[model samples]
Structure formats: C-alpha cells, structure tokens
Target: MFIPAIMAGGAGTRLWPLSRKEFPKQFLNLTSDQSMLQQTLARLEGTGHSNPILLASEKHRFLVAEQLRLSNVATSQIVLEPFGRNTAPAIAIATFMAASESPDNILLVLSADHNVADVAGFQKAILKAQALAENDYLVTFGIVPDTPETGYGYIKCGDPIDDNGQRVSAFVEKPDLATAQRYLDDGKHLWNSGMFMFKANVFLEELKKYQPDVFDYCQSAFNNMQSDHDFHRIPEDIFEKCPDISVDYAVMEQTASAAVVSLDVGWSDIGSWDALSKVLQKDENGNNLRGDAIALNTKNTLIFSENRLISTIGVQDLVIVETKDAVLVSHKDHVQDVKEVVSTLRKNDRNEADSHRQVYRPWGHYDSIDNGKRYQVKRIFVEPGAKLSVQMHHHRSEHWVVVSGTANVYCNGEKKLLTENQSVYIPIGAIHSLENPGKIPLEVIEVQSGSYLGEDDIERFEDRYGRVD
Candidate 1:
C-alpha cells in the first residue's frame, strides 16, 4: 500500500506579507479555493493511498489540523517537530513511523507547498516510481525542464533502468544563466521536484548506510515521541542533536540505489511572486489581479490585495501585494531577493516579519484594529463550539461587546449569555473565558485598558487545547 507522507513545515519567507512565519504559503489559497496543502492532499483522491502522515512544526499544529479538517483529509498521523532539522531528519522520522507499521509499505513523500497542474501526469509518474521502488530503488520524480531556469536544482539522469526509470547520475545545485542554458542544451538534466517514492525499509536502510548519525538521531527522537491529541511531539533535545541538512546531502546523493523518473507534469514550487503569476490566469494586459486590485497599462505583473484596493496605473513586470499590515512592491526580475527583506525585518526584531495584525489561534482569530499608549482595540472571531482558555490578565482589563451570534462568557466565576450588542466587562485580575455558544461564528469587539497590554500577560488556569505555557 502507498502511504503519503506530506512534509508541511516551511516558512515560505519569499512570499511574505501574505505568507508569514506563523501562517505560511502552504495554508494560503494561491491558485484555487483550496490551499496548496489541501490541494496536495486532494490530488491523491483517486490514487488508492492510505491516510497521509503530516509533518509540521509545533506552532503550526492547529493550522495543519484545521486545514486537513476543512479538506476532509483524515491523517493517519500529525507529527510535530519541536524544531526544524531540515528535510533529512523530517523524512527519516516519517520513514521510521511508516516502517513501524510495515517495512514493505511504499511511501510517497511530497512537499505540501508544491503545485502540480496535471494531476493525471503526476499520478502516472507516481505509478512508475512505485514500480521502481518495489525493486528496492530510491526513486525521485524529475521534472522535464522546459526553460533555462536557475532557481531550481537540477538532476542529471544516467542510463535508463527498468520500468522507465533512470539511474541518478548526479545532483547539481542552482546554476547561473549560462550554465542553466548549457544544462538545457544537454537534454540530460531535469529539475529536481523533491518528490520521492520508495519502500519504507529501503529508504531507512539507505539513510542508515549513507548517514548513520541522522538515522540514529531520528530513530531516538521518534522512539521517545509523546502524543498530544492529534499531534505526535518529537523530543526536542534528541532531535535538536541531529545534524541540520537536506535529504540530498544526507542520503540521495550518496546512495547508489537513487533513481529518477522523468515527469512531464506541470509543477511549480511557487517559490516567488513571479512563479505565482505564471500559474495564475492573466488578463489581456498580462496582469494577474486578485482580490480588490485594479491594474491599468500593466503587463506581466501580479497584484494581490487582501483587505484594501490596490491600483496600478502604468506598472509592468512588477508584483504588488498588500495585506493588512504590510505591502510588498517589487519588480519581477528581483522577486527572488524578497527573502532578504524578511531577513532584514528579522534582524530588526519586527513582528511584521513573523505575523500579520490578525493572528490565528486554535479556537479562532483576533485582529488588532487600533491601539494607543494605554489601550488597545481588537476584533475577535470565535468559531462555533470553540472557547478561549480560562485565564486572567495581570496588567489589563477587557470589555467584550458581541457584534454577531451569541457569546457565553465567564468572568470572575459569573456566567452570562450575551447576544448581539450586549457587552460584558472583566476587571483586572479577574479570571475570564469566552465561548461561542451559537451555531455560527461569534464576532466580538474587544476594548482593553492597561499599562502593559501585551499578549504574554495572560495566565492560563485551564485550556482545552492542552496549552501549558
């Protein structure tokens, strides 16, 4: 049986503003109504695969679960890494888990953030890789290059093997324009798609052979994993000792059993705004406009507006993205350099680099609408049947006014049912909790008054989400 292992942990810093560290691009609906991660799971609907094993970060566990629930993808396991140790360790843990179930299980490892336009072609490649995998070959799907693109790594194919697979000759890093052209001319190189298929035992054996330290560390971490609800938490200390490296550096490049299956499916990692623009529908002027965006005399440009109108008069070959708190305007040629902007924001300790004004929580989300030196205002939304932690603030007092639906609020051991336009006040140091008692989402406007109005001021006494700190 094929067990899909979806690697869903990535910052996706290149697509910032819209994609934050807390909420990355994989969770965003870039192409269709479903998110990239959801789309990744949906594409395997008819592929006769077992429930997927999702690997995500601890901070993103709720996002992964929520997205999967929305997509109706029942996950076999949701492994939570305390910290990222790169693809090598991530894949090793997943392989270990799958092998525990059955050593002969074929694992179809895929990144949750990729976009494959041709689902049929992708499934066909998987079938071919499965055949090669059954023969104990570590198989990777190599995309047939259509252009001399330097952004992606290239895989050089060797002599053809059985079942339409080729022995992997060598893995090459991203090259310059001239070298990329040379590789394209050679016709022996393909873009490294990072999608792989292999029997669980075969991959584990290769990993143990090529990089024993990574394998050993990953095994130790997985063995000591703790289960919390849907999340399987890996021991942070042991996993942190694992060397930080990619799978290519750890095993695939060193293993002699590595093989590549050429895939002609249209695939894009959507690494930048330019890549997203290429996949999206373009207007007569070659402009891809989304949300409340208007472009005039624009050619080969992408404009994405989330909460406000973004209008361009005469821009060409540009990407303009406006979110709640940040705006990114860059030329298409320089889209790859957008990561440097995120790096700069990090160095400055700016929160904008990590999240937006609106932050997602397990129960719901809250948007910071206004703030002052001694007060703050927020718009909070609570999903039906969800409740906030029973907690108290040390330095702030809160007043919640229900705007829609019904709110069951508990303040200072007093329970009250608040309907539309009704308000409640929780004094400083008073234990409080908010719940959505209605079938629909409960929207509340919150006004806070405090000398120190930070999120860290909350002291949780009880939480259903298993949050302790």
Candidate 2:
C-alpha cells in the first residue's frame, strides 16, 4: 500500500503580497481553479493510494482543513506543527506516524506548492519509484532538465538501478551559469525535484541511522502528540529541538539507498514570479496577465492584479503584482530577490508582510474597509451556523449593521435576532458573540470606536475553536 504525505508549511515569501505568512502560495489558486495544495491532492486521484497525511503548521490548520474540504479530498490525518522545524523533522514525524499505522506502507512525499502539468507522466514516475521503494531503496524524482537553470540544484545520475531509476551519483548545489551549462551538456544531470518515495519503516530506519537526533526528537514529539478534532498537535518544545534542516541534508545526501527516477513531466516549484510566468498563458505581446490586468507594448512580463485594474504600457521583462494591501514592481531578472522585500517589511514590523487586508478566521473572514485614529470599519462574513467566540474587548465598542442574512446577536446575556438593515450595539466590556443562524452567509458592516483597535484586545471567555491567546 502507498500513502501520500504532503509537506505544506512553506511561507512562500518570494511570491509576496499574493502570498503571505498567514496565507501562503500553496493555498492560492495561482495556476488553476484549484489551489496548489488542492492540485497536489487531486493529481493523486488515480494512483490508488490511501488517504493522504497532511502536515501543516498550526497557523495554517484551518486553511489545510478548508482547502481539503473544498477539494473533496479525504485525508487520513492532518498533523499540525507547533512551529516549523523545516522538512527533515516534518517528514520524520510523518514517517513515524505512517509507520505506526503500517510499516510496509510506501510514503510518497510531495511538496504542496508545485505545479505538475502532466499527471500521467507524474503517476508513471511514481510507479517506477514505488518499485524501487518496495526494494528498500530511497527514491527521489529528478526532473529532466530542459535548460541550464541556475536557480535549482542539480543531481548527477549514476548507473541504472531498476526500471528507469538511476543511482544518485552526487547532489550538486546551485551552480553558476557556466557550470549549469556544463551540467546541461553532460546530459547525466537532472534538477533535484525534492519529491521522494520510500517505505515507512525504511525511511525511519535510514533517518535513525544517519540523523538519530532528528529521528529521536521527532519520534518523541509524535509519541506525545495530542489530537484536537481532526488536527494532530505535536509537542512544541520537543519538536523545536530537532535540527533545522531539510530531508535532503539529513537523509537523502547520506543514505546509500538513495536512487533517482527521471521525470519528464512539466514541473515547476513556482519559487519566483518568473517561474510562474512560464507556466501561464502569454498574450500576443508575450505578457502574462491575470485578474483585471491589461498590458500594451509589454513583452515577457507578468502582471497580476487583485481587487484593482492594472494597466501597463511600454514595460518589458518586468513583474508587477498588486494586492489589496501591497504592490510589488520588480524587474524579471531580479524576481528572486523578492524575499528581501519581505525581510524589509519584517524588520520594520509591517503587518503587510504577514497578513492581507482580508483576514480569514475559522468561522469565516473579515475585511478592513477603512480605518482612522480611534475608529475602524470592517465588513465581516460569517458562514452559516458559525459563531465568533464568546468574548469582550477592553477598549473598543462596536456597532454591527447586518447587510444580509440573519444574525443572532448575544450581548451581555441579551440575545437578539437581527435581519437586513438592522443594527446592534456592543458596548466596551460587554461580553458578546455573533452567530449566523440562517441558511445563507451572514454579512455585517461593523463600526468600531475605540481607544485601541488592536486584535489583541479581545478576551475570550469561551471559544468553540479552542483558540487561546
């Protein structure tokens, strides 16, 4: 039996503005109607694998659950990391969890934010890798390189192992243009795709052999794991001690059982805007435009606009991305440096680096429409049958005007049913909650007048989602 394990913890800061720390690229539908995470799950439809094991950070637990529900993908487990310790510990925890279910089960490890165009070809590679994995050989899929791309690390292929698989000659780091060209000329090198397959017990044994500290820490974390609803929470303090490293460094690079399977499928990590542009359809002027964008005299450029119309003229080899909260304009050649922008935002303690103007909650979402000194206006949406926590704010008083559907408002033990055009006032220090008791979504325009409007001002007496701050 084979089980899919998706590593979905990346912040994807390089695609900033569109991708943030709160909502990363993996949850965004950059390539299709389905999100990258959904696509990753959908591609395994015909692979006859068991339900997937999703590993995500605690902050993204709701996203993982909601996306999987939208995709109609059934997962065996949703493991939540208290904090990210990189791929090595993440995969180690997955391996331990899977092995507890079945030691013989093969684990097909995949990244959440990758685009694979040819599903058949990808499945074919998985079949070949499964064969090698069944024989206890650790397998990684190597993308057939079509260009001298310096952004990706290269893997040198050795003698043929079995089926189309080859023993890994060596794992090479990202090289200079000249060296990358030589590697392309060699014809034996492939792009390290970072996808892997191995039996659960085999991976655990190899991890224990090569990186015992990581394996031990991960095992302990898993052993002490707690389950809250569908989410599996690992012990935070123990997991934090696991070495911060990738699986490539701790195991694949040192394991003699490592093998590489060549994959010719159209694949991309979408690590940068330039990489994303290659996969999207281009216009007559060789421009990739998405979401209310128009370009004139633009060539080899990517323009993405959300919540606004973006028009560009006489631009070449550029990337312009606009979000509700931030805009990024960069030369295509320097798109890789977009992470530096995120770093600068972090250094300045900017909220745009972490969240969008619209913030998603477990119940639904809220959009900040306008804000000024001591006051803020927000449009909040509540899913049917969902309710906010029983809470109160110390410094802010709020007035909620229902715009659509029905709202059951509870303010300091007074329960009132409100409909369209109706309003309710929540005084400061009044324990209050809002619920959508109707069938359709509940939309409300909330106006807050306060001394402090920070989110940290909320004191939750009770929360259904078990959120505590």
The collision pairs in model 1 are none
TM-score of 1: 0.98
State each model's CA lDDT, in order. Answer: 0.93, 0.93
What stretches of model 1 exceed 4 Å from their correct place?
none
lDDT of 1 by residue, 1-469 (tens): 6999999999998999789889999999999999999999999989899999999999999999999999898774999998889999999999999999999999999999999999998888888999999999999989999899998999999999976699999999999999999999999999999989999999999899889999899999999999977789999989989999999999899999999999887899999999999899989988999999877777888999999998888779999999988999999999989889999999999989988899999999999999999999999999999999999998999999999999999988889999999999999999999999889999999999999998989899999999975
Work out candidate 2's RMSD over C-alphas. Answer: 1.0
| C-alpha lDDT of residue 211 in model 2 | 93
- Candidate 2 steric clashes: 0
Candidate 2, residues 228-279, lDDT tens digits: the string is: 7889999988988889999999999999989999998999999999999999
